[model samples]
Target: MSPQQKALILLEKQGNFKVGSRSIPTPGTGQLLVKVYSAALNPVDYKIQVDGIFVTHYPAVLGVDIAGIVEELGEGVENFREGDKVLAHGNFYMIDQGAFQQYTLAVATFTAKIPSSQSFDSAATVPLGVDTAVAGLYGKHLGAGITPPWAKIVNDHEPKKPIVILGGSSSVGSYTIQLARLSGFYPIITTASPSNEDLVKDYGATHFFDRHLSASQLMVAINKVTDSPIRIVYDAISLPETQSVGWGLLAQNGILVLTLPALVKEDEGKGRKAVHTIGSPHLPHNNQELFRSSWGMIEKWLLEGIIQPNNREILPNGLEGIIGGLERMRMEQVSGTKLVAHPQETK
Candidate 1:
């Protein structure tokens, strides 16, 4: 019999998450078997339980951000080796690829070496949020069509532009602010509660505003920071009120990137557009080349402190602890921190 491991599985559509046992899956070609140390909770995890949106299979295992040690290498997998510390973009559609288990398979192209500077808990915060931010800002066909910092074609590094990010403390917004700075965007304005102002600034936001500000008030504050037309607004929240503020701030021909489906309709004659992004790298036409380009730089970026993980809040009770964490996220009680669970610690 194959060795078994503990997993949190949703038994049926829109069902409760329960801890159960499953065989540890073998790695396929260009994949690695990861012994998961830290698995991060995301809002979408609970949403999947309530809405039954992404996973199509019953008894689905769900989780997307994983940080762990590689335990075995599949044929032709050269980027990583057995025993290497790594972080990976886990896939929810496949039970073998999910992060909610003690051991799971990682597609090599979506994996990155975890540098010595970060803990497994910290690295667990990166995969989903980092991919979303990079794809939204740098993907040409899917995003704002901005040049990625790692692009080859003598890309401009000093555009000296201004960008506004709504929900600056959100995982996506925080990473966007950091990548914005790396791409040389100046006056990186963001909105969060006053309590997270310093947090966003530390993540490279040059200007911060209270998220509760009225639309006109936010506009007035943004105008004071830079007269430069806000050409790119990454609305991490994308709520109706937040979308309105982002749409109002966007310049002609600007792009408003949204994580959720767009609710605001574009004016008939306006050159502006709202793009709803599908950030999973496993999707068709996901631009694997573009992801590889950025994934290659992750180690150096983390080593040099160019990229930082979300503030981590380690959950108690190992694999069983994830349920409560997801509940907290669904209740909107978790703020400015990524909740991580240790599967190996499960009793």
Candidate 2:
């Protein structure tokens, strides 16, 4: 294969992005070239484009999640073949390669084998969301009270406490509910709009509080579900108001895990712990192990039909579709369903 390939290029610092041909990257030692099938657009993609935090070069690629077939493998690569179907969280902060293209290269450790039954669009959504949830909940012992990796730490405690997952309708929140329930915690509760109450419950939320409810009303609903008060809170939506509510709802000595930096002023009376989580996809190194372990568990649940991927709305126009889809997401406040882009759309 030639060393040149086409890609979606983000030119300069003006946030202008376009699809164009560029050099096809060769797999260096321990790297693999993935023939891109579909890519997921994340909030980070637009955020980075506007803020320019991680873009070190002009004409950079902006996608983080990729699903497709492996086209070639570099020296010393193991555990993958040329035709293997795979999904990866392409190097997000790394400037050299990204998923928004016909072909891209990734380090071996950052990729996972996609189950044959999984569609490329569905597989594309797993890496970033799963890895973020895994790393946030598992890394630094944030989810220490929940499961085996952390079960030992909470063992012999007086009583297991309930966990509160904010924005449970979101993809990461949905997965957190499942993982929290699997870890043997009692009463995994979530907060979301009424329309998603049934959907969230099916994802392992024992109870769902309406996010639009008044704080007092919401507290009443939450209190009715658990007598001891929420002991651990995962703020999938990390707005200040939401954090305040989470902090106010938490029990003494409890911890609040947030996806974004907490902006709420800490209440002086509450002895609750505050933890800001930067999700897994952003972490450097150990990407492969985390991706494989979490995806392995997710695949099992999916195979058994115990857990469902979040509802998705497919954008069939491929690369050109992203701009309009993103605009819609921003305007409509895309709630429950993940917006997906199928790059191979027939045009």
CA lDDT scores, all candidates in order = 0.91, 0.73
Where model 1 places Cα greater than 4 Å from the true spot, the runs are 152-159
lDDT value, residue 343 of candidate 1: 93
Model 2 lDDT tens row, 1-347: 46665566778775777766677778899889888888887777776777777577776787878888999999999889999988877875554458777788877766777776778877887767766666656655444233333334545464656888889998788877877766656778889999999999988888888887765777788778778767788888877888888877777777888877767655676777777765544454434454455555655555665456667778767776776666666565788888777665624
Top candidate (TM-score): 1
Model 1 lDDT per residue over 21-113, tens place:
999999999999999999998888998999989889988899999999999999999978889999999999999999999999999988999
Task: Tell me each candidate's TM-score.
Answer: 0.97, 0.88
**Which residue pairs overlap in candidate 1's backbone?**
none
Clashing pairs in 2: 4-24, 5-23, 5-24, 109-288, 132-280
User: Candidate 1 lDDT (Cα, whole model)?
Assistant: 0.91
lDDT of 2 at 78: 88
> What local lDDT does model 2 show for residue 293?
56
